[model samples]
Target: MKRIFKLRSELVFSAAISAIIAIIFAIILKEFILGSFLNNSKNTTEYVHDDVIAAIEYQLKNMNINDSNKVQKYMDKENSMLYLISIVHKDGKVIASNNKEIKSIDANEVVDGKKTFKFLNDNRKNLVKITRCDYLKDGCYLYYIYVGYGKLENENIVGIMTGIIFIIIFFLIIWKRISYISEIKSTVRSIAKGNLYERVPLKYKNELRELSEDINYMTSEMEKEDKKRSEFLTNISHDLRTPLTTILGYINMIKNGKYVSKDELNSYVDIMNKKSLYLKNILDDFFQYSKLSSKDIVLEKQKIELNELARQIVQEEEDEFIKNNLTLSINLMQEFIYIYVDPNLFLRAVNNLLSNALKYSKHNTSVEFNISKEKYNNKFYAIISASNIPEEPITDDEIENFFERLYKKDLSRQKEGSGLGLSIVKDIIKLHSGFVKTYKENNRLFFKIYMDIKF
Candidate 1:
């Protein structure tokens, strides 16, 4: 039964059932009020009839039928004493009545040896009481009365009915609102279960609308992340296979003695050695990234001058820079800029940055560096920035993701990198409580490092 209906429809139906039950209860209550009013009216009519009978019996004992003055006094007293009453003659004529139209008694029927009381207004169908009485000697004198009372009034019963109908309409509106929310929740659940395209209908401007928009945003982000993961796996597999294939091909050639010349054999052995080192580098990157991800790398902190550290890293890479025909520039603050950091990890970060600059920069292009101080909110920061002229400028978006594990900006340049150097640099900086960012300006890639000087 639950599966037979859509979630939205099921919610509406349940609400409708609740509304129907409430309406039924309300109707029953209205009927109960009407019934109670009818009963009270009957009681009032009986009490008034008894009073009239006692008055008539007293009049018969104390006054003659011809005494007009005495009868007029009695009529005034009865009018003041009863809720609603009337007197009529057997000739179908009215003598006195609380309501004028009720004065005429129908002669065709009799009740207790008197003419029957009939309702003068045909519209008042639920009149609860009608009583008749005889007082005169010829059975010509009759007392007639009718009374009605209830929660309903002639004018306001329409209003009451209108209110009841409005209640029903309000229930339906609530049901519809709830059903819409239910549908949205169901759609979100479906999306969470791997239906990437599942979406809620934008039917109204309410919480549900905002919720649907949030879900759509989340799903889009998830899809992007999934695509990145897939690409990362494919890139890793390719990197691994290329080195293994080279090593295997070279070993088979050596085993079959395909290189007859001593120089050719040495060259082949060198090639094999380079390919093995490349494979080892890739594996090492994977291990390092995995360790950083799990937060297993611990840092031993020490106070050191950042400018000195930068000079040392540049000196270490001087030979490689010269071999590659790349120009290295170093800028250091005149005063010592001291910071607390792990020296080895900090050097690794600076080294990785310099290595990346070397790998991406064009031959004979100068890589520039600036070591300076930036102040914000009365706090001083040691800022290290490096810029290199690359063969092609990287996009702003790609630069922001430079430190993501196994992320390569240009797949065609896969041979130049293991895609983990920048990631390691980022992790090391984070361990030192520093921040790093990259940007591209005027066809030159810029890397910025920020570290607190005071702490």
Candidate 2:
């Protein structure tokens, strides 16, 4: 047996099925009504024919056998009274028929002690009535009275069957509609219960499909915003703690008068200044991150030669590199690699990368800049990479989390700088429709930036 449908709260699947069943029942009822009407018509026609034949037989009994004009007048009058009636004789001859189509009746076929009565043809194509009577006083003379109406066709049956089939088809359609609605409701309920990934299994591009797609899109957006907010809170808490610790340390030093000598006092003041600057940077990073989250930052995009930009940033940081006794090297191809970007923001991002490299790199290790172009998917990309040998080998997991805001692998090195440098770099790259990633290979920390030239 086929599975029957189930009802659900959200969808009207069962109601739709019931509606279809009702329609089918109504169609069947209509067919039955028409069948009843046809059957009544057939019965009435048979009754009228029987009555006409009986009346003709009574008139014949009262008439004189020798009077031919009286018998003819009675037959003609009976024929005029019923249009479908016909009379036939015992010798297989049609004597008087209102319709010329009817043939003679056989009087040997008896029904209820009568030699002839009403009957249906072999194919039920015609209705017939037969009667037997003695016109003369002697029993040797026999006369057959044959009366026939018209045939009852099967057109009514055909119409009823058609109505039944239509009702079944209509019910099937309603059942399917109800099933679809139930599925939609089930999916919606699942989504309402915090199942952000829930979706309706819709196959067609109809109104239901569009509605399901819109709901899925909305859930995805809400999940993304929720994730960003959680990450923002975690990053803010971690980043703010480092600066506060440094500031508290400096204030403790001043309160204790630990810097008695002039040189010691100057060093303490320098430490305070650095700590204050670090706090200011952290505040700035927070503002920038908020702006990015709110979609407030706009890119001032323009074509820029990456080689020239790298060289200029490198030159600007030459003093710091030297002061830290770091060796820096630049490898640039002769061909100009141009990319559309916000120059100022791009410079800041590059500066952040270089600063990170300088701060984390072991003293006297070579920091290398390699600029090149990569072709992929029939599109050109400008790649700027910076790498330096770290004091210790960084782990793969650390590299994966390098761009996460305020994430630090070495907790002891927190005093060196604010931890939002790589986060800012990531935001800037995203703004340019580009990407940034970090990796550790051969005891060297590598940061690669990719910018699409085609966009």
Candidate 3:
């Protein structure tokens, strides 16, 4: 049989899978959040810078280059970011200027554009803006604004830490699951090695734990079957060997002329004949058991008077009942109890039950036999019971298991039987779409057969 696959890689793989997904999610979320904030920051900063640039443009358009003092003072006051402005006329005249020198022009390099670069590897920056004067027709002004920032790095670190924490927790849970799974594997391995007693002891419950419980139950049933098989072999060996040995000894004596008298020779032949018959009975039990135990065993169905068959069987065994010092009493319905069944197999089953009842019945005690009809769940049945008043009272537990092959009890008819009688009885009835049950009631041990009566 192919073994069941119970180990799950999904728990371990799910952690790694989800971590990858979480990391991707964090990156996307961080960029979105910070990108929006940076965009808002740019908008706010540009709003103020536009106003300052416009104010400078207005001052240059109306004010003359000669009154540089008023223009410089107004530019200094209007620039909110502390912009340093320097202007050089077309004749190289220092017309309107601030700061120590005209910035980025010692080499007489034409300053034509804005230059923004971070200082000290930090997001803080120096932003330089140069604009030509439309009003002066001579010089251009340079605006230098230094912008400082420090918080973006901290937010990136925070986002990464949040993702890492989530991954760590997920991995820990997966590790715990793996540990339990390994324990279950070990227990399963032990069971495979024929240690049916081992069990997986989970402190808590999960899917694997439930599977463990099922495995434990399977192991218990296997143990029972193994025990029964061993007992069956032992019983079969003893029953076969004893009779064969007796027959062999008698045949050897007759062959060797050890029995000189004709009477002695006849006695030896009779004894051998009886042993041969006994061996035949044992073999028959084995054959019938083998055939009946099959799941696909077929029955020859017929409508038969069930109570009439019961009466005939009782009459046939009447001599043996008397020999055993036991009496038989029957209660049967006057109306016919008809059942659909295999007639020959059903007769064997009934005979097995009678033999069992008589064998264990107390000497001079009455064995009660009954045939009746019953209706249950809209289904009709022919109910037959053969009960023996056992020498010792049979308990409910003993009665329940007595139908099992080779089942043993204290009154213990098992050792005397080939042990297939009751088992054969059970299988035969079940093949007829009926059930056999054993019960103890009113101080009598009963073997109750319920055969379905289909119209």
Backbone clashes (count) for model 3: 0
Which has the better TM-score: candidate 1, or candidate 2?
1
- Per-residue accuracy of model 2 over 114-218 as CA lDDT, tens digit each: 443444545542355544444332122224444444344344544565566555655565567567768888887887897877777754445656666777788
Query: Model 2, residue 33: displacement in angstroms?
Result: 14
Where in model 3 is the C-alpha error above 4 Å? 1-168, 375-380, 410-415
> What does the lDDT read for residue 88 in candidate 3?
52
Is 2 or 3 the stronger prediction by lDDT? 3
Q: Write the per-residue lDDT of candidate 1 for residues 220-257, one digit (tens) a residue.
A: 88777778778778877888788789889989999999
- My TM-score estimates for the predictions, one after another, are 0.65, 0.57, 0.65
Candidate 2 backbone collisions, by pair: 13-178, 116-130
* Pairs in clash, predicted candidate 3: none
Candidate 1's C-alpha runs over 4 A off are 1-168, 295-299, 376-378, 395-406, 427-431
Tens-place lDDT per residue, model 3, 110-224, is: 3444333332333422222322222233355444443443224535564676678667767776777777779888988998998878887853444676777787888888889
Candidate 3 whole-model C-alpha lDDT, 0 to 1? 0.70
How high is the CA lDDT of each candidate model? 0.70, 0.67, 0.70
